[model samples]
Target chain A: MDTFAKLQILSGAARYDVSCASSGSKREAPSCGTGNTSSSGICHSWADDGRCISLLKILLSNDCIYDCAYCVNRSTNPMERASFTAREVIEITLDFYRRNYIEGLFLSSAVMQSPDYTMESMVRVAEALRTEEQFGGYIHLKIIPGCSSELVRKAGLYADRISVNIELPSQASLQRLAPQKHKNAILEPMALIGREISTSLVERKVSRRAPQFAPAGQSTQMIIGASPENDFQILRLSQGLYKKMNLKRVYYSAYVPVTADNRLPVLASPPLLREHRLYQADWLLRFYGFSAEEILSEDAPHLDESFDPKTAWALRHPEFFPVEINRADFATLLRVPGIGVLSAKRIIAARRFSLITYEGMKKIGVVLKRAKYFITCSGRSFEKPDQPPALIRQQLLLSENREALVSAPSKQLVLPGFFA
Target chain B: MNQYLYDGTADGLLSAIAWILEEEPDPEKVMLRERMDTLFEEGFTIGTDATLAESLFFRLKQFAPDAAHTLYSFMLAEKEGMETSLLHYVSLAFKHGDQVKGYLTHPAVRDIVYIAKKAGRELHRMKGLLRFEKLRDGAYLAKMAPDYNIIHPLADYFSRRLRAQHWFIYDVKRRTAVRWNNGSLQFGTIEQFTTPAFSEDEKKVQALWQAFFKTIAIPERKNPRLQKSNMPMKYWKYLVEKQGE
Candidate 1:
């Protein structure tokens, strides 16, 4: 295939992997390199799907040896297959980076030949980009499951971030949906990358010249709604991963059905609202100091459709509400529905000069519609989460942007990959 | 009533604010020269005095260092009442001294911060949105017409990132450009700017990028409203991906 046709197919095949962050690395251009990465990643473009395009995300090859039923590139699936030579990949990356089209390359592939062969192909591309071109931009490499530890370690040396998608939440689901992928095969590399990252950080502290191994750390993704895992199970697994594996991020890609498989559940569309809620709950876990259990119990395994996880929590725990905004600690302010990390900091700082009123909250960019119910400026409530909890739920539901999020009908899209 | 006018430059505005705060007795009585009848009020034309501007900025740094950046970014806003609003902000900064930034709720400080945020956001966006096409002469040329005067802020960033490559970032709206020659940077006006033929590979790669952009979006989750919010229509004029959209 020509470069244009190859790019369309490879990038289309890779669109389902939605880890677009090119952040957490501050690699500067070496001598006369083409590009560099910012600590806060830059989004070069927004796709029609509203997802940020930070890197030139593409699969190295769509030809696979494994038959994973959920994947577009399953071996049994009838599709036009193609692969880019290392030189072709390098040329495209350098050209794109030079034109300021992408921060770097996010290179992945289906199992081409075998795990080791696939990883070696990816490593060659990254190694060439770093050594030959002296390119210092962000590079995220996906480690093929069952790859040797030596190749896994080599990948960490060149990649800013490395990942091995768990693909399914549980071992039972993995066995049923993806027969080739095993739980231990995925977690072993994840654990190896995590150790290498920590060791590299510690070594660099002793000597600035130590080799950086995935300085941005390791992250993984679990395809939600692909298997029968509930939010509670998925979130609990994420929390465990964050604690044990020292994972930086756990992306939850809403499973978009591509094939008619007896194992997979039929859905009208991707559960995007559920995916959005998972992201919101994920934020609560990562930043807002909420455990998975606190956000949702086994009984109430799903997030509320109307209210966000934060507001739902605020309503659940009314005692936490009516906290005085002026004196609320940083932790307290974080729990409030409308107050984010930035606005909470502003509230604290602004109060040191003068007491904040309800009007001042709006001026400081606080979303008062939700916050008014949960907070008070100075011992006086702006809008009370009054007697009946049901009434409060109704009011909160009315405040949300319903049309854009919930009710906006998903149109039938003519997919480019649908041609294959 | 007292009136003061400056050349609308950052330094000129700083000098005027310094003079008003230091020499003028009543800060509230001061108004812009073009904003009032100078025939009745005492009007002072504050020239672009670099010495006064530097001295005042030095003082502002001692009290609140970030306030200097806030003022500089807000000066690039070019809003209708930008000058008058900044005057109030400067007054608050001087009055509050070290504690100026903490008063986010104060009207004067709040308005200035909002303007500063907008300018800062534009500067960050322009850093990514600005596209460079390779020229036949082996130099890169990118053109932009940003909402704020962010061409100056971009100098240090691109200077280090694309240090080896000779490039020119042109601000077409302002009729000015920042030229980067290897490591050195030059900021000046080019009355009429034109580019010779682009390099042979530019069109091929542009086409490849446009294809990649379309192919990457998931068909199941197409949201043009969300796309427009992130990459606004205002920016679609120059983007290669949005050529046909």
Candidate 2:
């Protein structure tokens, strides 16, 4: 087949993997070579799915040996099978990078022949891009499970970021859905990559000339709604990954049912809203200093659908309301529903220069409609801050609807109480 | 109206600002000379003096280097009524020193910061949005008409990234282009340029990319609204993948 036809099949098959980040590596351009990596990654285009196309995310081949029930390219599935030659992969990467079509290449493959064979083929492409072409662009290699430690080590040397997908949340789900993939086959490589990454980071600190092994670190993804794992369990697993594995990011993909499997739960649509809420909660865990247990409890295992996790938390902890915007510390300010990492920092800095007011709150990027209900400026609350949490929740929900109505004014449907 | 007009360059804007501080305090209107005729009551088109502009910028830098950078970015914005905003922001920066940037409550500081950020983001976006097609001689040519004047920084960036290849980045709207021939850089206008013969592999690579672009989108989750919001319709004219769309 031609390269165009091959790319169409390979990229289409690779769309299930949702790891799209190309940031966190600032590889200096080789003296007379093409392309360079920026610390802040650039998106060449936005796929109609709204995901940023930072890298040429494609598989070297999609012909699988393992029969994972949830995957679209499981061995039993009747789909187009194609693989790019190592030379073809290199040429495509160089051409795309030169044209500024992608930040770099995100190369993955199924168990083509075996784990070692597939990984070696991928490493050849990466090593050639680095050695022959002097390509300094970002390369994110998806490590095949059950791959050798030696190949994993070699892959890290050329890749800026490496990910080993933990595909399912629990061992039980892995056993039931994917009997072929062992939990150890995935975790062992993750452990190895994590160790090498930290070792390289320490070495780089000692000497600038040290070869960086996965300078952007490692990340993993688990399919949400594929197995019976609740949001609490998913978040707990992510928190553990962050704390233990030293993972850069933990992606949560809302599982899209492709294969007709008896093991998988039937859904009308991918649980995208749940996926979005999980991302918000993940942000709270990583940036906002919230823990998994803090965000959710055993009783309340699911995130509240009406409001975001942050607002929901605020409503539950009613005593935390009327948080003095001017007097609150950075951490406290971040806990507020409307204030984000940026706005919280802004409020902190701006307050040092001048007293923050209700109007100034809006100016400094605070979403006052949500903030006004839960915060006080200069010991003065927006509405006394004595309203019940239920009332506050209703008011916040109303404001959000009003905003939704205003933004999509093209839609003739209007919500009542918008004027009030 | 008390009008202080100047040329539409950053230096000219600074010189007019200098005129405001020293000679013409509290000018009701500060704008480009091309627009001065419409509301000309009493106006002086301040001759853009590099030394005077430098000295004013020097003072602003000493007070707040970040504010100075923000002002430079704001000048790059070149929006209508931008001179007035620049004048107000500079006066505030001089009075409040580095604290002026964080003083988002003040409309003057807020407006300048917002415009500067907007202009700066365009420069960053164009770094990825730029598309290069290889010419027959192996030189790459990209054409863009960005919302802001970002070609200067965009060219400076690619000069390093593509230092091994000859390339020209043309700003179609501004009637200018930046050329880097393997190593050295050149800047001028290409008044009578046409689509030259492309290299043998250019069409093949573009088709492959367009094919990859189509296959990448998940059919189940097609949100054109979000895609358009990120990569606006205005930018799609030059994009190869958005060719058919």
**Top DockQ model:** 1
Error in Å for residue B245 of model 1: 3.2
Candidate 1: which pairs clash?
Answer: none
Looking only at chain B, model 2 earns a TM-score of 0.87
Candidate 2: regions farther than 4 A off: A402-420, B1-8, B18-40, B43-47, B58-63, B94-98
Task: Please give the distance, in angstroms, between residue B1's alpha carbon in candidate 1 and its true position after superposition.
Answer: 6.6
- Clash number for every model? 0, 0
Measured with C-alpha atoms, the lDDT of residue A84 in candidate 1 is 97
Candidate 2 colliding pairs, count: 0
Per-residue lDDT tens digits for candidate 2, residues A196-310, read 9989989999999999999888989889999998999999999999999989888878889999989899999888888888988988998899999999999999998767899
Chain A only, candidate 2, TM-score:
0.96
What is residue A240's positional error in candidate 2, in angstroms? 0.7
Task: Give interface RMSD, every candidate, in order.
Answer: 1.6, 1.8
